[model samples]
Structures are given as C-alpha cells and as structure tokens.
Target chain A: MKPTTSDADENSPDLLLFRYVEGDLDAAQVQELEARLASDAALRDELAFWKESFAEPEAYDTAHLEKSLLVPVEPRWTGSYFGTWIFILTLTVTLFRPVPVAMETRPVLIPAPVSTPAVADVVTEARNPEEAITRSRMTRITLPFREKRLPETIEVERNVNESIIPAPIPGIKSRPPEVLSPVAQLPLTGIKVQKVKPKPKPIAVARTLSRRQGRAIMRMKEKARQQRKADQFLKGNVPYVVPLNSENF
Target chain B: MRTFLKAGLVWSGILLSFACYGQVIPLGALPMQYNPAFAGEAGGPRFNFNLGLLTASRFRHNEYNLNTSYDQFIPAIRSGVGFSAGYFTSSFPYSSSSEGYKFSVAVAPKFSLKGKYTISPSLDLTYGSSATSWNPRPGTAKPLNLSGYHLLSRAAVLINSRKWYIGYSVDIPLHNTYQYYRYRLFGRSDISPERFNSYWQFGYTFQRSSESKFSFTPQLVFLTGTDRYNRYSRNSFRYFAPEAFSLNFRYGKFIWGANNAGFHLGMQTERVRVMVSNGFGRRGLVTSDGLGSDAYTGNLSFRYMLKQSRW
Candidate 1:
C-alpha cells in the first residue's frame, strides 16, 4: 500500500498532525498518520501536545443570564399604575355584578270612612204630624237619602293610571283685590261716534316660493338691474358731474 | 373553566392597559350603513376590514362578525364607486344557529361648493340573505329551516367643509322574499319585517389653527326606523404628524339592542390605519342566552389605502 503523501502533508507534516488532532483528516490520511505515529514516538508526543493545547474551554455558569431572561421586573406603583389598577378593578366588578332589583311597592288602599246611621233621616221621621205636615208643605219633596259605599280594600294597580299629586308648596299668601266703587258712568255729552278708517292690509311680505328659489330670483333681478345701469353709463345716457373745485378732480 | 376565563379576562385587561388606546367602530362607521357618500372620501382607493367578537360570562356561544369593503374615486368623472361585503354568524349550543350575508354597491358623485366645500349624493343597492337552522333530537321529526332574502336601496347626501360635515340617508326595502313567503305560508301579511329607516350624522372638528396638528372632533348620529332606533355619539382627540394618534370616547346603541359605552384608541399613517376597542355591554347577538348576562365586546379594524394606478 502506498503511503498517503498528499501535497499538504509532504510540505508540512506538522500541519497534517494538526489536522489529525482536529479530526479534519480523511480515513486514508488518518491511517497514514497513525502508521507514522506508530513508527515515530516523537510524532505521537507532538500530536498529544497539540490536542492538550487546543482543547475547548469547559462550559461556564449561566445562572445570571437565565434569571435575567425568565424573571419579570417589579414595577413601581406610580400614579398611572394606580389608576390602571383602579380602572381594572372597576371593570371587573362591573362585569361580574349581579342583576339589579327594581324598587317598586304595591299600592296601599285607604280604609273607607266608617259607616254611621243618618241622624237627619231619623229626626225627620220622628217629627210631630203637624210640624211634618207644615215642613212637607213648605219644603220641596226630596228623595230618600242613600249613601254609596266604596269597598274597604280597593286594590289599585301601581304605576297604571295612578295619579301622584305633589304636596302644595308652602309660604304663599292670597290677597283679594280691593273693589273700587263702580266707576262713575262716563259722561254721554262728550261721547262722539268718530268715522274710523279701515287699516290698510299688511304688505304681502310672505314669500310664495321657497326661500332659496326666491333669493335666487332676487339675485338675478339685481344683477340685470346693475347691468342696465352699467350699459346706460357706458352709452353716455347719464351726465357726469362737473368738479366743483379743480382740486376735487 | 370559569376561573380560567376570569384569569384570561384579567390578562386581557392588563394587556389593554399597556395599549391604552383604542376606538370603537359601530355600524355607523361603515359607509354602507351611515352614508354611502363617504365612499372614497379619503381621495384615494381604500380597503377596509373589520372583525367583531361578542362573548358573555357563560361562554357556551360566541358571535362573530366580519366585514370588508373596497372603494375609490375617479377624478375624470368626479364620481366614486364602492363595494362592500359582510357576513355574521351566531349559534346556540346544540340547538339552533343563524347566519347572514350581504353585498352592496354604491355610486356617489361629488360637487364642489364655493371652492371650499364638497357636496356628495350617493345611492346604494344591496342584496342580503339570511338562514336559520334548528337541530332536533335524533328521534324527533325532521329539522326546520327558515331562510329569507331581501333587496334594499339607500339614498344619502353629505355636505363636507374643511372642519364640518353633515349627512342624511334613508333606506328603503325594494323586495323581501321572506315577508312574501311568510305571508303565503301563514296566510297573513300583517306582520311585516321591513320598514323605512333614516339616518342623520353631524360632526365638527375644532383645531387650534390651520397649521396646528392637534384637533378635536365631536360627532353625533341618529338612526330611526319603524323597527329600531339607534343613537351614537363620539368625542375624539387626534394628534397628527407623520403618524396620527387618536383617542375617542363612544356611546351608542346598535341594532338588535346592543348598547355599549367604551373608550377607543387608534393610530393612522399614510397607508394604514388600525383601531381596536373593548367594551362591556349586554350581547344582543343571542338575546335568549345573552339577556341580563354581562358581555365583553372587542372590535378590531384595519384600513389600507392602495395606489390609484394599481386599482
């Protein structure tokens, strides 16, 4: 078998040894280098020295870096922070809040007035015949008195057709106006029937058309009038005033 | 599961605190709903995409909605054309589900006034379809399905000045297959499902000076119809530079009874604008399950302006 003497190994065996230590050599180069190493002890020693000097450093501690990446920084409770928390709290409370109960009450019915026998009817019946006859003749005949009674407990539907009259405000005093003796009758001698003239009907200022259309028509008329004036002036129909003073020119 | 959900919510809250800026884009923000004349108001071809999520405490069901639009102005004709599409789906666990899809096209022509103001009048045509499916037990009879189709036309007018804008729009249903079918099926046409809807929008911007970069805008919108009523208002503060940052407070009642009040943060650059908002309100998506239950709503929107030549 031919020795593996590539160009690089022939010029520099140390380079080949370096490649061998770094595991950069192919299988053939490795076999050649190993064979040479077995023959020369000095080459083996040089290879061992290279391996020891070029060895990679041991792994370093990364506890600080891991902490920096994983841990969260504590924030100071500034005003803005406080406000944010407060808003969050309010929102959470609102979101999870219970349904509100409506404030309502049943209507309370007032007790009807206590029932009592009518004394007037009994007195009228008990009157003497003569006095009754006189009273009957002098007074108009009236129907027997009947009182309509409301139920003791009338159930009124709350919030439906219920009238709530506010209490009258306090501190008001009423003063009746003083009546002056009727004014003396106006003297007829001075009263005269004057011929009254009918007031003229108001000028029809109300527009019959929309304000915008009316304004547009007015603008067109004004423009035509102004054009007419300009034309007249240009045709010398209007006289130019002579200057009262030379300096006024 | 409840504890985990609460924790997740708390985490989201914390993240939102860091963001500190967001804005809500109700239906009023959509050109199709508010004013079709708003299409291509930015003067360049633009695309908009939006995502909305509705979740409640008992997370058995969640509702999701998606919307996107494309629009551009043609300088030669002094007119703008816009097209928008939207889809939303909601489900009730193991029982029923409903979904809807809508597509719309709008045309608006611009007219200049006094060399400083713009008057735009637009018309929009829409085709919408909705389907609902009910699931029954294995041994029960066949499932029932209800589907409907509708066509709507909207006319809108907008007046825009340097710092002020006002618009009004009205929606009319041209055709409704559902109502006709329902009338035929049930033998009565008394229960109509569609009615005339009108919208009004007004806004004014306040700035320190013409050259200043900071501005405040207060906007109001009212939507009235025979079937529903909605009121939306927003107060926004914006700081403009190469990039613009804005903060807005919004309060509104959306269709189907979704009422919300929340804060919004937004950022806008030349080509892109992003907005996100979170609010707590009653989710009206599934009224039966969402009623009286607290809900959290989050909306994210993106606007991209494309080069005119590319379009």
Candidate 2:
C-alpha cells in the first residue's frame, strides 16, 4: 500500500501547505482558498484540526496520529518495514555481542599415538551377558572422567586460540608442535592425565618370550591398568583443553 | 616525557584551533557550543606518529597522550597535537621549481546519522615557502617566491555501507601569496564562493581498509570557479573564464591529480594525491604556440598522514 499524505491526515495544514508552497500559480481558485482561511470559522476549525493532529496526538485517534508521524507504521510481523526493523535490531545485537574470543584458541591437539592393536575399530553387535555388564560399568566410569577433564585441559593450553602460526620472526625459528606438561606431573607421580607421546602401539606377542621381554609388555599393560585406576579415582568433573601445559607430550 | 607531552598538547591545540577556524566558516558556530551532557567532561587526547618516509611504515600510537588514542578514542571530534614536515615540487608552464618542508595544523570532524550516512569535515592549515625557478624565464619578473601559508578546509560525507557521498567544500586562501603569472590565476585558484570559490562534489569509496588510507577513495569530482585571469603572450593570447570538468582519481590529503598552478607532489603517506601538482591543466580547444600541452604535475611531500583512523 502506498503511503500518501492526506491518507494520514484528511485535514492537515502542512499537507495543504506542501502543494502550494512551490511554483507560481495564477489560479483564482487557489487565491480564493488562501483568502478563505482567515474569515471562515469552520475553515479555522479544520485548520486547527490539522495542526493539533500532530501537536496534540493524545487528543486525536491513535491510528490516524500514528500514520501521520510515519514511524513503525507497518502492521504485520512477518513482512513489510517491521520485518526489516526486526532484522536490523537482531543483527546489531548479534554483531556487538561479546564473542569470548578464547574459543578460537583451541589447544593444538597433539593427539596421543595409539597402540595399533588396541584401537581397532569395533563393530556394534549383540554382546554376551558377562561382557555387556562389564562394558556398561566401564562406560559409566570412563564417560565421567572424560567429561570432567576437558575444561581443566583447555584452561591450561597456551596456543589454542590461533589457527595459523604468525610470520616467522626473522631472527627466530619455529619448533615442531610439542606438549610441555607440568614438571611436577611426571610419570613417577600417580597422576593419570593422558600424555601425547608418539610411541608406536604395542603388538601382542606370544607369552613364550623371556622374562626381560615380558617385563616390557607387562610395563605397557601396567601403565594401561594404572590409567583405569586413576580414571576411577577422579572424584569431580572438569572439561579440559589439555596440552603440554597440562600433561606430558 | 613531560616536556614532550606539553609540546604535543600545544601542537594539537594549534591544529585544533586552526581546524575549528576553518570548520566555523561552513558550519557557523556549531563546533564550540558545549553540550550540557559533556560540559565538564574531557575526552580523547590522541597521539600518533608515522614514519615520514616511504618504505618506513612503522607507526606508533598515542605518543603524545600516553596511549590515550586507543582506549580514550573519540568519535568524529578529537583533540590532540602533531608535528609534520614535508617537501613539494611545482612545475609551472615556464619552468619547474621544488618547494619543500611544509607544516600543517590539522582538524577532522566526522558526523553521522545512525546506520545511514557519515560526514567528516577536516581542515589542513598549512604554510610552505617555495623553491621555484621559472622555465624560459619571464623578463624582469621577480622570482614567484610564494613564502606564506596554504589552507585547505574540506568537508566530506560518506555512507556507512553503500559507499556513496555528497560533499560541500570550500578552499579558503589564508596568509599566503603567489607570484601568480596573469595566466596562472585562472590556472591556480578557481572563482571561490564568498570571494572564495566552492566545489560541490560527489564521490564513491570503491577501495577501503587500514592500509589503503587515502588510496581507497576513487572520486569523480567536478571543479568550477572563475577569476579575471588573462594569459597574453608575445607568442599567443589566452583568457581564463571558468573551467569545469569531472576529475577522476584517488586523491591523497594534499594533492589531487598532477597540476602546475599551485598543486605540487609530495609523498608523505597515502596515495592518489594532487601533489604540489604543477603542469596539470588540460587546455580546452585553445592552444599556446598551437601546442595543446598541459603541464601535469606530481609532487612528493615530507609530512606523512596518520592512518585514516576511527576515533
């Protein structure tokens, strides 16, 4: 719908004045109309109606007064200027929202090297009764540990926010991505936070080997068992952005 | 630090006073009317330094106000002091001369309507003495030694998104002089409004960002003005009335595309300047020695402009 002047105020003086304001008109009718505004009471009343239409908006019809001001005049929510206004408001709020830029600093994930045999992709199938109960217990215990450590790991990470490394400082060279866990959290400690060492996965050799060889395999098994014990040992939950800052690499 | 800070304040005040002097002419007393909300409040005193030569773009911020420019950044209107020096070379029809070491008092105010259009009016009150030597030297004419000031007060309006603008600009002659050859007056100063000619301009900002500075503005400007200027020669006779055309280019702070009249080329920072541009008037269907030669000038400046910053 086209918004025109008189449609808003049928007796507006500003509207009346706008048309005659420009150009030289020799029309006798225009001359008579100008002369009439001075003497006629009804014309004065009508002109007063025009002036007060905007000036004394509380005295007039709300709809007509609103139309005159040319404000948020559109009615529907989905279409028209109202929609545009909503979009602008939403965009402004969204753009200015504090973006907690720390999210951009995801710790450079130097993923732990997995034992080739231990990490085989498993297919989902109906499980044996004994295995199912054990697996359910394992998941219940493991899930909480994973969820709890995430935040702690993230907080300790240093270079997680930036994606690309900055231009190499001319005098300085870059080293490969490495984790630097806290010195206090060495292997001798019972702490079980995962480390990201690039050790090859241990292969299951037959147990017929000598005691020295068995001890190596046993040590790997010993470490895995210690991890499980610590997993159960953790009492509270914390999400982590773990890196060299939090653990051994 | 205290002495440097004081100098900076004094310098900024000088530039600000000169800037307001220029703005007051066009706006008529709006720059100083204190707002009740800001009556006792003091805001953004900034200090920025630019390496004055090309290939040295390392700029330091807030040297004068102790890093106040970033956190205490002002909007449109800012108060601060700066010192700049630059050189310019002018090439006139008869000969070419190089004018160096220009100093300026700068002011910039940007006004805007929310989410729509932005208006920035800035002034540069500059004084530069000349180093000029005429070519085919005129007879008994004292060397056109223009040892005075050049003031350029400009108002610019820009759109927030559409990149369109309409501006009203007036270049007022300050405490300056020109050994204007009769022919050069028509070629130098256009007929100004209020005895100073005005140029109504329309422009489009095609390229923009931090590094671009003035390099980003590609404007189509129309210049029209007149003064009684006569170019009578033993070889040819020419008269100056009013010349008008749409000049298109990227203009830096001081220079527009090459001109000889007063415009010289001095590069401090930024691009597309009308350097003390000498030899830049394109002759219309008329000829001197029947040679349609327009001396296009390009000057390099010593004073570098700070980045086109948002205060």
TM-score of each: 0.43, 0.27
Q: Where is model 2 more than 4 Å wrong at Cα?
A: A1-249, B1-86, B90-101, B135-162, B179-195, B205-218, B230-311
Interface RMSD of each: 24.1, 25.1
The lDDT of each candidate is 0.56, 0.33
Worst window of 10 by summed lDDT in candidate 1 chain B: B250-259
What's the chain B TM-score of candidate 2?
0.40
Task: For model 2, report DockQ.
Answer: 0.01
Which has the greatest TM-score?
Answer: 1
Question: For every model in order, what is the number of clashing pairs?
Answer: 5, 61
Cα miss at B286, model 1 (Å)?
Answer: 17
Model 1 ranges with Cα > 4 A deviation: A1-249, B1-29, B135-142, B179-194, B227-261, B282-290, B307-311
Task: Please give the fraction of native interface contacts (Cα pairs under 8 Å between A and B) kept by each candidate.
Answer: 0.00, 0.00
